[model samples]
Target: MTKVAVLGAGSWGTALAAVLASNGHDCTLWSRRTEQAEEIAEKHTNEQYLPGAVLPDTLKADHNLARAVSGASIIVMAVPTKGIRKVCRDLNSVLEGPVLFAHVSKGIEPDTHKRISEVMEEELDREICQGIVVLSGPSHAEEVIRNQPTTVTVAAKNTEHARRVQDLFMNQSFRVYTNDDVVGVEIGGALKNIIALAAGVTDGLGYGDNAKAALITRGLAEITRLGVAMGANPLTFSGLSGLGDLIVTCTSVHSRNWRAGNMLGKGKSLDEVLDSMGMVVEGVRTTKAAHQLSKECGVPMPITEALYAVLFEGQKPIDRVELLMGRMKKNETEDLAGWS
Candidate 1:
């Protein structure tokens, strides 16, 4: 069994640790809080993040950074995008040798607009990191922990490292696929949350499936436009990370982004929704980053702009929707001819 350290105790991290432990890997989950670590070890349940899920008994938890990564040859970074740099720096200080790093979090760095892998490369010592891989798709932690059938993709510039991560997590209930398009995968994963939030707003506004469907479809168009400008393959947006993830995040109750948007659409202030959820709604932050990125990339991301206005500029969600619907008309496939 391979030794793996999952460097976050949040739902996704805990669920991934459970997957590793179930596959007979010696997996340790690390949390910044000693109490959280102890709770996972003793209770086999992270009540705060993952309420009813029971983790594998063989899985270990550690509060100490050094202790958690001591013997691990593989590190699964599950920290939020906001915390990635600090965690990578901490890991770099304690790492003894080169190791394969796999990150599952999705979101662009607000100021730098760097993808998670780029941030990792900046913070982690080259001598200590063998390669950086991103693990992402439509899988949710709640369903994954239940051993429900799930499929996800791992991507890296090095195909070998991506396949290595695939082997580490694949099982009867969990399936893994490998892709070489790291930019596409990361972009698709990060931007879907923004569309999901817009979808939630549609639902909250009492708009029917027509509006939701349009948001998701047009949202993919916007995401693909930006991703292509940033050097990603257009076809990747049609795969699991793009269309699949967008659908799930936009529809599911388990999505924090969707829930937060729903609250906002129903008239709760941004601060109120955030306070009530008690968890990070990545879309909130990503919307700002995406809005800035669209401008920098010379891409038109109307939905992202609208969401940014609603979330940050105090424009009403309904007014933003009106703004979107009132945009200048063009052929649906106007800019997509070159993508094929």
Candidate 2:
């Protein structure tokens, strides 16, 4: 059995660890919280995150970072984007032997504007890191924990590593696909959360499906623009991590980003909304990174700009909507012009 160490123990981390364990991998989930580790190890339940779902019997949990990664073949970094650097630094100090790295967290670092994989590359010791793979798509933790049918893409520069990850997570209930475009996959997955939050704002403002449909479409174009400018394949934006992820996160009730946006639309302050949603809304931080990235790339991401204004500039959601609507009109295909 492949020895896998999944670090995080949040909903997504716990769910993924359960999948690995169910697939017969020797998996250990590491939580920073001692009590959380105790509960998962002893009770086999992560009630706060997974609610009614029970984890696999074979799955294990530990609060000790060294204990979790000890003798592991693969280390899955599932911590939040904000926590990635610290986790990687910790991993570098404790790591021994070569281990394949796969990251499931989606976000660009705000100041460095690095994707999760990029952050890993910068922090991880090159001698020991076998390769970096990214797992991303429309699959949600709530549904996946229940053994529901789910599909996702694993991307890496090394095709072999991507396929290996594909084998690691693929099963009847969990389907996996492989892609070589790491840049495309990471960009699509991270940027979609920004669009989903905007979608949530539309829903909260009592706008109908028409507005959401338009927002999602325009948001994809904006994401594509930024992604391509930043060295991503244009076609990747149309794949699972791109269009597929956008559809799920924007429409599903399980999306924390959307829910946070909904609260913002209902006139709650950003601070209030974040306080209510116990989980981290990745889109908030992603929006900041995207806003800065767009400026750096000289890409016109109006949707991202509007969301940024509402999120950080103290502009009202409704006002931003009007600003978006009143902007200069252009051919829809204009943005896709240079894409070959």
RMSD (CA, Å), candidate 1 to true, equals: 0.7
Model 1 residue runs over 4 Å out of place are none
**What is candidate 2's lDDT per residue for 103-160, written digit by digit as tens?**
9999999999999999999998998899999999998999999999999999999999
The candidate maximizing lDDT is 2
What TM-score, computed on C-alpha atoms, does each candidate reach? 0.99, 0.99
In candidate 1, residue 76 scores what lDDT? 98
lDDT of each: 0.93, 0.94
Off by over 4 Å in 2: none
Q: What is the alpha-carbon lDDT for the whole of candidate 1?
A: 0.93
Report backbone clashes per prediction: 0, 0
Question: For candidate 1, which ten residues in a row score worst on lDDT?
Answer: 331-340
Question: Least accurate stretch of 10 residues (summed lDDT) in model 2?
Answer: 331-340
